[model samples]
Target: MSESIRNLLEQVKNGQVSVDTALLKLKTKPIDDLGYAQVDLHRVVRQGVPEVIYGAGKTGEQIVGIISSMKANGQCQILITRLSPDIAVYIQKKYEMTFVESAHIGYIGDIPIQKTKSSIAIITGGTSDYKVAEECAVTAEFYGNKVERVYDVGVAGIHRLLQNLERIMSAKVIVVIAGMEGALASVVGGLVDVPVIAVPTSVGYGTSFGGVAALLSMLNSCASGVTVVNIDNGFGAAYMANMINHIGESK
Candidate 1:
């Protein structure tokens, strides 16, 4: 702004900058011009979050274009969810700051990232369920929450989870990933006091219907504070976990 608006009003009393000059500076706030692929101007300011690019079904060029624009505004730590390995490799070749996760192939920048020590525990029912669980973990980490991953402790081996129950209970939030019968969420809910974010993976066959059965089972859990996100939506689960974990940090 060319004029100091707050100072100008005081100046009116003490005779410094004019009211008209103050008005001119107030009218020149920063605004963003919409691009061909996105109108991602005020995302962080309005929603208390930044724009997240969903990499599935989008071309590499489109991903590059989106990242280019986001970077121009100094908004780093961009996350591209559901990206394939090919696309992730392509993105990595272009931008060297990428982290391609094992659970999901999402790409995240290691720059300008927010940092938080309040932890979120990401657990998987089995090895097959790790992909979605990884997505949740990576997403939470990108959103500036410290993450502790507890992998392959499915309900069939109840002792596996119970062995780590203390670690599980230590988290500010817990994301439980499962597929078969989706019983892990309920099991977790019965164990911890923190919010349980359940994610159902499409890991089984015949009766699984690409994870809908697990999704339903999670949604219908009898546990008191169990909340569920969409099947295979690791990003969504992490976003919720970050939101929950950062509640105190914002204060």
Candidate 2:
């Protein structure tokens, strides 16, 4: 259960809040209908993480409205992914937020405190893949996981990746980001005992098919522990990595 639900139940047991009042709160708190968007107010209660705004197609006003509803429902921190710098500027005028242009991610309110000691390693095959890698790093950090970034370590430069063996080996989870054949994920997967999440970026020549080639390459990886996400889906990779990193930790 969420902290709010547990506290509410405790209050009812101690007669601080009437049972009927608590019931009413529970019945009405799950969703907030805004016509344009049905803001999920109870996602934190169910998934331990609040709803994240996808700002690609959303107007600045719509994003602000969702943030308003979330804040009114007691969600202090909000994450907005795939947000454009222009929309970010418009949102910032109303609410103070940090925007990362490279990752196209926005943060509202303070980042959560770290919940575990384990760290997540993010490795990028080439400099062109840094944008996707940054998204993974920011998402993982926002979720309170310590992140170690080893960028431009693609298989082309095998020595560079090998030099970072200690950092990669010590991580609880690893996110390997690459484009142009995407062989880096398999290489890392073979060396690490932990799970490897592969993200294929749209950063290659004409024949890459906008990351399809890399995605297929990762899916067909020979390594045992390698897993693949959709093209440029850093947020998904980070979410799964954070879950794996926090396993057995007290929520």
Top TM-score: which candidate number?
Answer: 2
User: Against the true structure, what is each candidate's TM-score?
Assistant: 0.82, 0.93
Clashes in model 1: which pairs?
A: 103-131
Q: lDDT per residue, candidate 1, 116-209, as tens digits?
A: 7678999999999877877787777766688889999998999999999888898999999999789999999988889999999999988999
State the weakest 10-residue window (summed lDDT) of model 1.
Answer: 1-10
For candidate 2, write residues 122-229 as lDDT tens digits: 999999998899999999999888899999998988999999999999999999999999999999999999999999999999999999999999999999999999
